[model samples]
Target: MTIEVRVPTLGESVTEATVATWFKKPGDTVAVDEMLCELETDKVTVEVPAPAAGTLSDIVAAEGETVGVDALLANIAEGEGAAPAPKAEAPKQEAPAASGGGAGKSIDVMVPTLGESVTEATVATWFKSVGDSVEQDEMLCELETDKVSVEVPAPAAGVLAEIVAAEGATVDASAKLAVITSGGAAPKAAPEANAQAADGKAYTATTPGKDVEDAPSAKKAMAEAGISRDQVTGTGRDGRVMKEDVAKAVSSASAAPKASAPAAAPRAPSPAEDAAREERVKMTRLRQTIARRLKDAQNTAAILTTYNEVDMTEVMALRNTYKDQFEKKHGVRMGFMSFFTKACCHALKEVPEVNAEIDGTDIVYKNFVHMGVAAGTPQGLVVPVIRDADQMSFAEIEKAIAEKGRRARDGKLSMAEMQGGTFTISNGGVYGSLMSSPILNPPQSGILGMHKIQDRPMVINGEIKIRPMMYLALSYDHRIVDGKGAVTFLVRVKEALEDPRRLLMDL
Candidate 1:
């Protein structure tokens, strides 16, 4: 029997991917759950796994060819190895002779279904140990997908018999994780729900004194948060703390204090070890897409940037004065972006070409503003759109932009939130950028870059005065928008921002 291997669902907004590399070829014996090939999408790389322990019979999708989600990638001949192992290991029926129990059974703890398009997860943490007793529905381990962290619960009240999947190992949905032996006594079962380890608090399957390994992303997060591994509640396989886990620990006051981590003793380097080392890693789907899109924009568009400076004195004073009442009335903090977004809306209306796209010999103009706000994340930069920005009030705009930014950092924003924006606003001010020429997000003809606000001496009515000023760069496609229109559009935004009454009175 030949079982067809199909592409699993890609994450939100990603419908298809290119076959980057094939790990196995036809006639090659592959174990059940072994990766057969890699599918590179716009957001992330997905490994296509073998459906059964068998010889690869045929390749349906060749490397570099695009294939949609659920499309056939290859075929595997079943029973090529000892009757293929089940997607999940079944519990042993026979009881061990030493353990006096009726029909000793062991149930497999398999990876649970996460959500749509999520096929596999990396083991982040394991709460229970081999020979440890666990209660049903209790969190046994945590699984980290590309987007979120999920805790795996115990399926049965029994002793953890064996761990099939270790921390940092990635497994498919419904794949075997560990074995739980029913009616078996734990060597030293804890009396309470949250009991500490007797030998040591470190929850791992490794030998004593061995340094615990963390996934690279998780390590970076932990380091940035100034947290040691033991201080975090791990959700990765084998009780390994993931990046999100550290983030949560940093946020919560109740999180554990720093614990001494096992150190790897330093050794004198050999001649080979002293040489410069290099490593190569495949670009993630998100990074790859970003590169492609930026290059495409540069190649296709007649890009030109127009610059101007804005005095933020009045806007800052307005915010400082009404921020308290604004937050109370709207349930969201007043921000500079909302003002800019509203100002841009009015400007885009005056210069419609900035909000237009080229559609193969025709120019398509949008009446309403769909604003894309660029936010940086650990994975990469993402721009989630605020639909119909022109129709929204200051409070509404602030709320929408804030929510998108929060979700972007947490990796919770959906693909729909990322698609279809008429104009983009990228604020380099938050990162202390003095000036930058922001790139245009294609299809959209324009992008507005906001720079850091600095106190500078400026001439006012022939007298020098200190004022808060910001440099703004408007990058637009010259193919659709003329230099005059672009400059006028930027000036309108500057006028609206400089004088707050213009935004309130629709000036």
Candidate 2:
């Protein structure tokens, strides 16, 4: 029997995708649910997995080719031929352990505990395979948890002896991942070295005995940088190549001419030269989704931004007065976000249109507020909603925001937490953004942008005084919210924030 592998649904509003890379080629055996290829869409890259354990028989779609959702990617031949091949190759792979001397010195690679709550993670990608050379501290694989992606490093230099957990496999912390044959010799350098060695002198050109005793990391680095082991000055035990030496060589390779001839006039390179200097990498699924959604929000919505300035003096004073006590009582710091969130909730209640969305030809008004708080992560910006934020106490709001922000960056947020936000608040002020009009998180009619505070002269009762002021921007869907309503909403938020007691009074 032959099984057809098809691309899965990419995401909401994502219909088509480009084949980014194929992990398995024709004649290669694959296990059930094993990832075979990656499909890159405008929103995210989706992994196509094997339908069954079999041998890859054909590739219907090639790399860089576009295909719609559920389109056939390849075929796999199952039954006898496919099933017996892996068994046949198993002995050949294990043969090295029996034949090689000092094989028992291999280092066991185990999964490290991620956190108090996390115990298991999925193997995201494997950088090196069995028999592939690796260096100590070099990334060997990536582990994906509910909240974050962690890179597993090589424990010792040598060959990747075995793989206990394949990509997409879930394992507990402290579980064996793979093994590295420490003290084993590296594989011969690429054919490029042999070409350089054609003159015979190339082999012995580097310091005598330098390449022989070089650390696996240094040797791997030397090969990648195209520098002979002898050329780099060793800084490791017994004058062996260190990872840093390889890095220096790589850095030097780019600025080689400049370093050698500092007085020479620099010349512009041609298109070919420029192309050689550039690098291309496939975007991750998270980044693609962020780009697509943000672009779609701009094209589909009638976005109008309204600005206002808020006096932060009162809010700061309140926080300064009670932050210590608040932290001690609630076990979470009193942050400015909770205050702003409360103010937005109150304003949203008064001005309901800002909390509404356009559903096809009709207006959808949400009675309950699921406030989305924008958090920046290494991957991209993610908004996790605090359900019924309007009903949450200040201490509860502070705790939820802190937990969600931490989980968002760690990649632990659930899909439910990111869905169905009635309103959003983005604080670019944390990043020193003086002012910015934030875009709407689609379907939601409004987003409040908070910016950096600065001391400016202001009149408070006929006297000029320096006060901390912050610029606020509210970007809303003009289709749903009117200019008057947008302005009125901003004013209400400002009033609530400037007078923090209003939040307590629900005024």
lDDT scores for all predictions? 0.78, 0.77
- What's the TM-score of every candidate structure? 0.59, 0.57
What RMSD does each model have against the real structure? 10.4, 12.4
- Candidate 2: the clashing residue pairs are 43-288, 43-289, 45-285, 146-411, 146-412, 147-410, 147-411, 147-412, 148-410, 206-230
Tens-place lDDT per residue, model 2, 1-507, is: 999998876667788999988988988887655668877766444667676767898999999999988889999998766655654234334424532543435456767544334557776556664566788899887776654567788867777666667655678765667766666553333212321121233322123344233443455556666666656776754455667878886787777665354576888889998776554433444566678889999999999999999999999999999999999999999999999999999999899999999989999889999999999875568899999998999999999999999898666776557877999999999999999989999989999999999999999999999999999999999998999999999999999989999998989
How high a TM-score does candidate 2 get?
0.57
List the lowest-lDDT window of 10 residues for candidate 1: 190-199
Each prediction's total of clashing residue pairs, residues at least 3 apart in sequence or on different chains, is 13, 10
Cα distance off (Å), candidate 1, residue 376: 2.3
Per-residue lDDT tens digits for candidate 1, residues 324-394, read: 99999999999999999999999998999999999999999999899999998765778999999999999
- Report lDDT (Cα) of residue 256, candidate 2: 66
